[model samples]
Target: MSNVLRIALVDPNDSTREMLKAMLLGMDTVWLEADCSRYEFFSDIIEQTAPDVGVVTLDSDEDRAIALVERLSKEAKDTVILAASESTDGHLILRTIRSGAREFLTLPVTKDDLAAALGRVSQQKFGTADGGGRSCEVIAIAGATGGVGTTSASVNLGCILASDSRNSVALLDLDLALGDADVFLDAIPDYTLADVVQNISRLDIQLLKQSLTKHSSGLYLLPRPVELHDTASITDESLRKVIGLLKASFSHLIIDLSKTYSPVDMAAIEAASRVILMTQLDLPCLRNVVRLMMSFEEIEGLQSKVEIVVNRAGLESGQISLKKAKETLGREVYALLPNDYRTMVEVRNNGVPLITQAPKAAITQAMRDLAAKLQGKSGGKVEAEPDKSAESKWKKFWPGAAKS
Candidate 1:
């Protein structure tokens, strides 16, 4: 409870422990009072040292670590319990929090993450908010196929969200090979996802935030790597680790995903609170939407989180009707993005956001409504579905489709 806070830690891996120690040495307000390798012996060290904070690394043995946390929460009431792990899966974080950990840190232990955790303990024990981060809402935008305006929706929605002075939004261009989110905003970033993954050991919230390209609308952009080879090492776990850190700092994370539905996209989808499936009222897009929905049905709880959005709804005379599109998707379209070829093409070529270039355009209003829907506000009404008995080529095309 003094100016310098006392700390004790338990991590079995010598390398990871040393890395953590080096990180802690750089933090000026913290003092390493004692350290232990064994989970059972950690309690005794805390009892003897009387440290203000106790750090427990859970990757070595999760069961024992949770048990130790529960025990310390009751026995050593004065010390704040903090948990760490290489995995950011919700199950571990939830269980650790339930066992009475004050803050959960992801491993290799970013310095800012540690400082924020300890700062939270300081605030709770004495009233301060030095490094605490407000919680963030993550939204994943996926395309049914190419040219469906997935990136366009993502960038515009992000810009609209950032228009509010009270909000801070970050856009992640996960389209590794063909991403244009950076070009969309006309902001070139110094670093990309690959740089973050390669330098993960040295990354902290402060450093990572500084590396991103901040747009004039106050939106932070993390674009895809410049070279295709740079994306090879960006795996699901690494992407999750980066996302976990970003979630700690931003208010909103808009992930513009690659259309491949690879492991990387699955990881982002798994982490998102809202998933927008961008589709147009065309035969190919609709079929792909249903196919994707079938895949989602297999993934336990994924289907419920998705919202089917129809882009370029009134683009052409031959396109499918909104009523029939609903019957084809077997679900109501979340929102309709009107087709404004001149406005959109100009905005894209000029590298300006629709929200900025064409503020009064109908598509811009559609972006606002999309943001409102994500925020649980009243959105534009969806058209009601027509009769299932109506002879439909889509129903006949794909057997065992959803009931109309």
Candidate 2:
């Protein structure tokens, strides 16, 4: 048996279908199942190969696409089917999902959308990025409370990976208007995320990549719009499509989600392979994290994927210890990043990652440790010790998660 996640591509256009297959195969770790267009051929290969995921082109005719989804669902209940079409109607997209498509996209197929869809499929099958074999990791950075340094963590982490000379990382600022990722990177993109979201139906990997600004470190950044109101109403559906595209193109995909929760942010959260909830050691931050932890625990398949990160951990002491915070929130603080004033200002002034500015700083070292963990390194000294008493508290707080 092949050791890769088998993906079946179904599109009639020879170029489009082959291009999709080739792009996926370029990953060198994915197994391409039989490519077919005709309904009969598709059914045959699907039964014979038993692909992990399905990619079917949505016909101009809704009835035809709906019928295809229905038939595929009956044949492979466990398999996820992703649909693609040439239109970007909200009603049509919703209708397809309701009909049984796990995901939807518009063509000429941007690499970003394709990647996001594949990432979703990978997550659904394997649970986490680390659980899967040879797939990109989707890490989302969000704040438990506003201004907890989620954006900075994401930006610096992305920069570190991009500059490591080992992997390709793409940084996405999903904050829409208030996003400072571009400003921090000192990049003023001529094209904002508005171009991709508004023109998603016509998106392709080439155009999507072209829309981004490449840093000297080889990091690709997708910045939000300069005017927040322009994209405040952006839908989760649109965000998923774009993120999916990025996943297909980059090995390490980092998302800087908006501080406040919205449809766009929720979509990113759901699609995240792992969510880093940033917080500080303060009463309000702890309280908010406790509440947010409850919500994460309540949501299916979200609890185990969330990683609590305490930024500027040593900045304030005694307001709350890591033990008390974990006890209150019912989760472990996966990483503790210190505050270094000089490094902070340097990053702010230069619009680059702290690792690039002061790689030896206390804060940068903490980030490097976190990144190493993400890359599956082990035996490194942990900065914070696990609180034993907090274990019972967490179990009581989230019985289901504890039981699982």
Candidate 3:
């Protein structure tokens, strides 16, 4: 009697499967349990053979391969799936990982590489892996309308969060077609969110990091697609999966959303720990904020997580005052960002975050304060007391407004 590892092989090529079986038979520590030409019977093979490991060949049929891996991972919980492919394309490797493969190997496999891969599987099975599970806080930022400084705020906030050495931050430009987050950081990423979504089935922490463009401030950005047509390929399910993976891998996840509330936008909102609703000190922006708040209130527990951010506060003389704005919206102002037009323009032109270029600027300090409040480092205070008299006025404007 000899100690052996039970293995199951699934390959469409007859000759390749036979060769692999012969190689495994030659190894005293390995036991060939089953061999097949297709993955459709993988469940039956797993039940009959009780394989400790399942090696499946991935060829031109990528969708079928991915589905097989996913099903095996879910159905045969005790068995680990190792995907093998002739092509060493990065996208293919990523898709394999996303499809729930425990490991990926290139074809014409060597015994040493095979042994190393199996070693890891054994370690994971015995619970000796370090930092096996971790979670991250996800924050979603949305503007009431265009030019409300939503992208600017998100970039600065992400930079500030990443400033902490212990924290890892990722900023996702969910606007898809019209995102400018990369421009704010002055980064021209080779890979965008479209690349990630297209290969979403293979997405893992390593693949995600590869797709992101890193900034000098240590923030990672997943930019929007360069072409508008690519946006159509991004589905709500894919967005959720990408966001879910980001949440698991980073310390902070920031999403900059377009003004329109598409299904994908709603999915991001649902995943967010807090939704920063950005607005300006203007009548139209204020009215839109009220309407958004009413909609959020309809969703269970969403209203409580919303924090109102008044961007470009005190910019113009005729703009709505923060005091009156709060009364009109029937909620406390979460934070006030100062208006610094010249500095903003310079920062935008330079494609650098305000925190990095002008660290001591008032606007930068305001951004820092907001970050601290979000991280629970400071208790965010309302600058002015709510006017009880204005409560009636808000009700008159919108009878459904919640009384403060």
lDDT, candidates in the order shown: 0.83, 0.76, 0.82
Clashes of each: 0, 15, 4
Provide the lDDT at 239 for model 1: 96
Off by over 4 Å in 2: 1-133, 316-318, 380-404
Q: Distance from true position, residue 297, model 2, in Å?
A: 1.9
The residue-level lDDT of candidate 3 at 381 comes to 61
> What TM-score does candidate 1 get on C-alpha atoms?
0.67
In model 3, what are the clashing residue pairs, if there are any? 94-202, 95-202, 98-201, 98-202
Candidate 3 lDDT by residue in tens digits, 1-404: 01234588898888777777777656534546678887787679887666778999888477887888989888888888999888899998998899889899887888777777776775565432221222367889999999999999999999999989878999999988788999999999999999999997765455678899999999999999999999998988999878866765577999999888999998899889899999998888888887786678678988777888988887768698877877776668888899999999999999989987899999999999999999888965644554567656655555455554
* Local accuracy of candidate 2 as per-residue lDDT tens digits, 245-312: 67656778899998777878888888888888898898778767766766766679997778888888
Q: Which of the numbered candidates is closest to the native, going by highest TM-score?
A: 1
Worst 10 residues of 3 by lDDT: 126-135
**2 against 3, candidate with superior lDDT:** 3
lDDT of 1 at 206: 56
Q: What is the C-alpha RMSD of each candidate to the true structure, in Å?
A: 11.5, 13.1, 13.3
**Sorted on TM-score, highest at the top, how do the candidates line up?**
1, 3, 2
TM-score to true structure, per model: 0.67, 0.65, 0.66
